[model samples]
Target chain A: MTMAADNRPANAVPRTANRDPYTPQTLLEVAVEVFNERGYDGTSMEHLSRAAGISKSSIYHHVRSKEELLRRAVSHALDGLFAVLDEPAARHGRAVDRLEHVTRRTTLTLIERLPYVTLLLRVRGNTGTERWALERRREFDHRVAELLRQAVSEGDLRADVDVRLATRLLFGMINSIAEWYRPGRGDAASAQEITEAVVTTAFGGLRLRQ
Target chain B: MTMAADNRPANAVPRTANRDPYTPQTLLEVAVEVFNERGYDGTSMEHLSRAAGISKSSIYHHVRSKEELLRRAVSHALDGLFAVLDEPAARHGRAVDRLEHVTRRTTLTLIERLPYVTLLLRVRGNTGTERWALERRREFDHRVAELLRQAVSEGDLRADVDVRLATRLLFGMINSIAEWYRPGRGDAASAQEITEAVVTTAFGGLRLRQ
Candidate 1:
């Protein structure tokens, strides 16, 4: 797995005849796959190296440690989800509409970043990265719950259910997308289709009208 | 953690002054807790021993192996969930009402068997027991999906959404209760209340009604 000894610039095209170079981004993708397969706690550097088709030292050259890989993967997922909140629809719409927008976008994001989001969801607060992910997830949930509360107060949603419980059930429905959704598999639903289903089902229950 | 050497049968009450006797049921509970704290693959017999406050030999006395404990835990959870389908409300009603009964009962069973259900949710198909659990879970899901199909055919539910997707989202919302739910933690909702919320949120969205 050693690169050629020639002192070509690191950014230049790879000198190796057959081996693909490992960028941090590519390595992170490999690491997330391994982490999901073996679990974050069960994966080892050797396991990652085998899966990536790279050596341990080569992996270290890209990321310092496995935990760093976890932090990066979940960070990407969290970033995608948190970014949804700032979209024009999420920001400017009526509370119910904004909540629907967030819900749809969040489902799309989870599908777009399936492995990273799956890792984020499976975290059990076992490490700093997992705990941090949990906290950020809570923050995101709270923000959505606030949207639900506002929607209810605006007489747009049902007032009978607890906002916190409603928010959890809504996202719970969305997040479960990661568990069964397989991208590019046989007859998989398009991201748009899933988003529509999630939005309709979630808001259909919460909205006061048919 | 050795039991006193007595000629009495293993089932006899313990002779130890202060130590509580560990029944297989009690031991299985401890194993499930440790398995959840540590990912099932990451947990060892030693870990179970530590958590159970028993010796390795004593743990073996109750169960042949860690996998046996896992089998027991998941079986208990699966039995509870599958039993919901057998209830009269689930078996004989309007398709929509039967679906609602299954949804509400599944939520209550999840809360009632939180740890076992949580473990069931997090299994990653790493071992035989895990694989078996996954297959059983799929069968259960397929059964519910059929109910959704029936409901849609009967015009009790909206036909716009895919029946399979609707069933998945419904149970996804129900199963996620295992992730964040902490029974008796603080002002926790009762099983009946959560059942009401799940039924309302899920059917509220699915039913063809105002």
Candidate 2:
């Protein structure tokens, strides 16, 4: 073991000399995977390095800390979700229709950004970043709640159920997709089919209409 | 800052001589609170001891291990859920009616056993006990799926949506109550209101009935 002393100059073998360099983008993909698999708290820098096939020093080059990786991932997911609210379909319609449009689009956004949203849904507000994510999540929910209230006032949605409770159940059904949905699994529901299932069950009622 | 070594007999200041002894039931409540606060993996026997105001050795006198506490908690929740299926209303009614009854009751069960079910919902299958809990959960889902299929065949529920997917969504909506519901808290929905909201929005749909 003592015979392995290096004689080569420091410049002879740079860290990135042997293969493609690890970019922040690529490193982030690995970090999110590890985080989702082993929860945000359970994951450590060493886990990320082992998962990414890089050294601790190499990982530091890409991100400042694990929380930075978390912020970047959730921000991507939140960006996708918040954009759905701005869609023309979501914006210019009867309140019920607009609510449905938002629901449909939010479902698609969640499926498209499954890993990120899965991570987002599991945040417990233990850190400043997680608390910020939770606040943003509440803002999104509040916007949706307003849409629901408008729909109820317009006599479109059922007026009997509490609008806030209805909103939670609606998104609850959508968010549960993260717990079980596997995009490429055998016999998986097509995106169109899943979207239809959500909209139809949520708005049309499970009982057949006359 | 070193403490003086004890010179008295061990029985002079026995650990539990002056305290309300830690029973398994109260110990489990403390353990679950800690587990939910710091995830199961994050929690330790030391954490449990600190939360219960007892020593780890005292805890071991009541339960075998942390996993035993997890098993006990989830089993309590699961027993409440599975018992719903055996009720006369659940077992003897029309399939759709039975499904609705089960849904309404399960929602109530979750709210009643909020802490227990909350811990059950967060199990990640990291240990044998968790995996067992997951299997029991899936069995419960399968039973409900069968009820949904029966309802679909009976022409009570709509036949268009996939039966299993509908079952998942229905229960998903029910299960999400664990995330935000705070029993006895100010502005918390009473069990009656919560149950009505779930049943109405789930079966009657959120859209106004003409």
Candidate 3:
């Protein structure tokens, strides 16, 4: 929830702990939530205004357009995921090891920024901002696909599976987390357990090891 | 494309061949495409009319409301998937074998009914029809989860991963096919190969076999 507040643009966002006294960052948070609840195309600025309990002008004052809020929200998610690729574990290691590291970190990032990442996954390239988001997503997938190819060549990961197909399925399973993972309900697994399950299920497969 | 026509309602639908001719069945086809392209909520009767090259009243004549189209579309998807469970291969086998059979069949079903299933996967439960779709989807998932549980009990599947989580990840990967799978393209893998890849990756770990 505080994710937007943590990375402030200084003058662009007021330093307030409350959801009120809207900052561009905080307002972006509201917009992402609404965009997810009502499909992005269905959501109007009026909906955003109502969700924030503020006037349209108040929303307009913070962000130039709905697309701007969208750009910022998806950027926040993409930045977090791309940052995982830049981490030391992800950057330098045996390719399979690095892929595992990136997978784990990416899952955590999705959880930490659930609403924002949810919106990013649902983007369908209708607007300029959406198209940009899709391109960046493709770039991220390509990087991970390279890691998978390297792992296959190195003989660490299974060579029988197609690298690109494996990449899509692997990330596809990870992204599927957005659809159902709810953090900290009474019966839900802890974040660590969920992360462990993803890593185990992705690399190890579901067949019982002999 | 002929899926909509295969099982027609005796009294409710007209028999037609061309997309422009506007059979109730064919109109449902057009409406499903538009619903998926524009998120269901974002799509209006006007958009459907434009997409179908028919008047709004013409559409209303064929289907009472947009929700009617949605109901039929998702029902087609759900029926396809539920039929997989009733297959002899899926019904009579070792728990793990049945699970794999269902997995392979479900992947093929998703491909066969790709557009309908894609729209089904994206429903968010905003309307009564959407909520009904959500409920049926949950029922379908529950039955699959039961098979996973059985597999684990028989020690054919990994006992360590939670059954529900594994079920989600498995189908999540299968369902993820809707995101990028395009059939019959020049360079794309054949649907047969895609189904094999899903089976291999889901049951066999991505790591090289010893």
Candidate 4:
């Protein structure tokens, strides 16, 4: 099982495994859960220490502060997302085709890393780290927008739709995945299925007829 | 020119024109701003008073307390949304057509009442009012999902797509309008243009060929 699955609580903090001592990675996994529950600003060192069964001072030994935890969590999400852009399918295909590949990978990554990504989506640009993450997120959006613009330029997408509007529309569909998706629900649709539906709805409107 | 323009700040308390001094409507406008700023749970009556430029005792003359203010604000947003369901376009058209109308109106309402709607979107099931609002929101979703199901049954929508997925995909496109859509930039698309773009993208692929 993945660390995320083994490490997370269904709705709150996970159990501390007696087998492993506290490390930055283990502490982050606990901190992310507390952050999600009480919210980033609402959570404090006391909460993290209690959840991790570590001294508050010990947590500081591994990370600078709660903000560092947030930065690390969001970075995990960003890295997962940016990595999708470098995949062969995202790079080597027709603009529309490449976009579809990115869209599918994005949905899958979001589902697979549900907690990290959820925290990423909830950011409101309050702190320096948060503002940085938001900037990077906009950069990611612009990169994907460039692909949509290229698709429109190549006549592979509908000419009537504005590319900027189309980009937001595509991302709107992708980002809302965080609002409703829950992992490990017996009846929940698999990430592939969710990605397929999103890609179909977004690209279905843009793809040129043969 | 419109009250909406006066009420646009994400956290600025709205002041009423009446010198009668305080009404529930005016008090709610101020309370919602505080709630949006400090968050529903994070806010206190003192915070509301500071924002409203009134004393806690004076606020009680208008609102019972902070939670009452949250109830009123969410109730206002719920009423606006439910009102859309009763419109002629939403009620009298073909299922697919009606869904498009709902999608458009929902997007417009969300943008027009951006702060209130943003607050509504961010609520977790923390209190009685929040839970009630979430249940109502789910009912609204299920109602729209039923329309998509009906359209598929009538062969007016693509049978390949899942109805629940389609409903979420459509609203994902709509709810996202709140995230980055600024009101008055010279380059910003008008509300009509946005509604049109959202409706077109939402239904373009789903509509059966004539």
Highest TM-score model number: 2
What is the overall TM-score of model 1 with all chains considered together?
A: 0.87
Question: Which lDDT tens digits does candidate 2 get at residues B5-123?
Answer: 24222223344523535556656776777898898988999988877666777888888899999999899889999999999999997999999989999998888888889899988
Residue pairs of candidate 2 with colliding backbone atoms = none
List runs of model 1 lying over 4 Å from the truth.
A1-20, A206-210, B1-20, B206-210
CAPRI accuracy category, model 4: acceptable
Which whole-number lDDT from 0 to 100 does residue B4 have in model 1? 29
lDDT of 1 by residue, B34-96 (tens): 898887988999888766665788777788998999999999999999999999999997888
The global C-alpha lDDT for each of the candidates, from Candidate 1 onward, is 0.81, 0.84, 0.85, 0.78
Q: Report DockQ per prediction, comma-separated.
A: 0.39, 0.67, 0.74, 0.42
| TM-score of candidate 3 versus the correct structure, residues matched by position | 0.89
**What interface-residue Cα RMSD does candidate 1 give after superposition?**
4.1
Residue B168 CA error for candidate 2 (Å)?
Answer: 1.1
| Residues A60-157, model 2: lDDT tens digits | 88789999999999998899999988999988989999999999999998888888999999987988999999999999999999999999999999
Task: List the candidate 4 regions with Cα displacement exceeding 4 Å.
Answer: A1-20, A205-210, B1-22, B205-210
Model 3 residue A113 CA deviation (Å) reads: 1.2
- Residues forming the 10-long window of minimal summed lDDT in candidate 1 chain A: A1-10
In the predicted model 3, the residue pairs found to clash are none
Clashes of each: 0, 0, 0, 0
Interface RMSD of each: 4.1, 0.8, 0.8, 4.5
